[model samples]
Target: MKWASDSITAGQITLLRVLFGFLPVLGYALARRALSRHHARHLHHYFAMSLLATSVFYYAFAAGTALLPSGIAGALSGAIPLFTFVCALAFLRSEPVTLLRFLGVLIGFGGVLLIARPWETTHGVDPTGVLFMLLGAASVGASFVYARKFISPLGIAPAALTTYQIGLALLTLMVVTDLDGMTTLADDTRALVGVVIGLGILGTGVAYILYYFIVETLGAVTASSATYIPPVVALAIGWLLVGEPLQLRDGIAVLLILSGVAVLRVTPRSGAAVSPTPRWGPR
Candidate 1:
């Protein structure tokens, strides 16, 4: 959304994040009769997770995209699974450890290494941008782990959780947002509105709905492994449409991410025990 970055600051984008990303979701949740005040009551249990997952996730991402090439940003997203794997292992102790799962985590991280290639300045990627990507990845990673632990145990419906999560995120964004940045949208209302709505509905709303699906069905680590795909797609878009050069390292990074995800997919075969237990009521 940096097309308007010249006019808008990241804080302003974050303020809009509430409207663009979560408001439609809240409306959707209410329309489906999926949310209520009672759900909000237990929301404190999920408050931090939702906050990290959505608000912090998008804020850092807005900064990252503003500063970095879309391809590099995509590659950085690959860090989510790795970060989640570590988070789950350390924080969400319910997930069992196995050789294959460990191997998958390592393999995925190896792919991230090839993509980041911090030693090279060939692409002119901004270091601050890379840091933003990592922070975003870490936020999502920790949130996923927390979801499987604290949120899933509540046995709340995924739709309701989506509503609450996005709702909480909206509230958090409001606290830090700058209303004056709205002046930037005066020039390009369509692109600005479109960016907000598209990202809000598709990226944050629909995306997280699907995300919880994987979190529930597979273990959290497996769910996090999905992170690897977006970077490859981003790289392709950058190369084909945006005219960003995809270096040979980028190509190898894609292959490694594919291989890493393949390894992660194999994890579920031996990882059934680690899957979040799906008993029918809250703990």
Candidate 2:
């Protein structure tokens, strides 16, 4: 997506996302996997989840990053898990929303505030971009509930689930995408095209497999907590790689976010069992 985002128009990049992102899953979807009539009919649900989780999320994320600093954007993007927890409370009957988890989410959001400091800067961050980031976070957050409520119960393996999701996303993207812009890739240097391949296969495709499994194993809110990592990484990259200023607030924000995640891992007062059972066992 990073590579395609450079040369391809936003509309084109959205289309190429399906192309690059689906490459890793091309064979996996075709591999033998039993599909019930219900699973077949409900495929649209998975596609819809993917649409928001990946496609829409990508759109908002791209727009946000284009407008905001990397650290600020990453910090804001970490809200996905918080949104996931809220969605879980409202939607999933199984998501146990203990005081600790709720408080932790609050703490995390507080840290996000320190990291973002939206009040401190109105110069660089556009309201539209901030709205896009929030939308991306919300879409990703909702995706977790959608997966837990709709997809997990279907007794589908994560790999197979990801396979079908990506394959279907590809088909959906094709219908709306302009084919003419795809030829622009021919003019791109080999390195740029290779980056596109890497981003598609390694970043989007493989990551979805791990992400879906995590959602299956840990529940959406727990799995979504992994969102905390990117902000710290983005801060580091911005400082070391890009020479962006690393403020004291950034360090403090990182510590607070980590603490918030630790708070979530604390044992519940009831000490309820949290081990997850995947609906479909490995083939």
Candidate 3:
């Protein structure tokens, strides 16, 4: 993945961008096919547009990384759950925001500050890149809320949803990318293939499927808490795969974030109406 970070040429970066951008769409389709027999739904049209917006933000981040520090990028991303909570409140009023949830958001935000230590940045991160990433998070949060309010009610299979999302994303990528430039694939075929396949299928495809399932069961606001899980996974991967030094601060931050998520999860329902349990597939 860091190879993506290390990409030198514009072509390489674009390739990575398109591949990663198209990932979730592919994930959606694969997930849908695996989960149910129903045809894809009209809701997929909105999901596709959302996926495109997500791709723009993701690609912009990847392209602009040189303008921003890695620590800052990671730090800014931690705000996703907070954004999710805010979006839930403003848009999806069904999600109950209680005192405990507010406290949890504060604690999680504090953890992000501890982790990023943004004050230490010498060159400073790109403001625009940061904004784009935050916007991306907000968009995803909105998508989650929409899925809960609109998509889940129709009882469409998650697998079908997954398929439509990924397939549309893939089509979008195919249209945007110049096929002639794909010759770069021959230079570092193995690495390129690895990135495309891993990010495309697993990171984007499978991840969203699991995400949709979680959303279906947990409700969007609650399921959004899973945003807390990735940083820990990234930290572990960095330590194990790249031998990056694991600092004590990382451990402490992880604890605080997890604790906040737990607080949000276990607190009593705040008289918020719950969505009906999805029946999984077609009616």
Q: What lDDT would each prediction earn against the true structure?
A: 0.73, 0.69, 0.58
- The TM-scores of all predictions, comma-separated, are 0.86, 0.82, 0.71
**By descending lDDT, how would the candidates be arranged?**
1, 2, 3
**Model 1 lowest lDDT segment of ten:** 274-283
Runs with alpha carbons beyond 4 Å of true place in candidate 3:
8-49, 52-57, 60-78, 123-133, 176-182, 243-247, 268-283
- For model 3, how many clashes? 11
Q: What lDDT would candidate 3 get against the real structure?
A: 0.58
lDDT of 1 by residue, 1-283 (tens): 5555556876677667556667666676678787766776786866787677887888898888789778778777877877787788798756667687678767767776676677888758788887898899889989888888877767777778877777777777777786775776768886576567756667777787676767777767777777767888888888897798888877787677656656655535654334343433222
Candidate 1 residue 17 Cα shift, in angstroms, is 3.1
Question: Whole-model lDDT for model 2 versus the true structure?
Answer: 0.69
What's the true lDDT of residue 165 in model 2?
73
Record all residue pairs in model 1 with backbone atoms less than 3 Å apart, i.e. clashing.
Answer: 20-200, 21-200
* RMSD, one per candidate, in order: 3.1, 3.4, 5.0
- Of candidate 2, the 10-residue stretch with the lowest lDDT total is 274-283
Off-target runs (Cα >4 Å) in candidate 2 are 1-8, 32-38, 121-123, 175-195, 270-283
lDDT of 2 by residue, 142-218 (tens): 99878877887776767677767777777776777667756776677762565456556776787787877777777
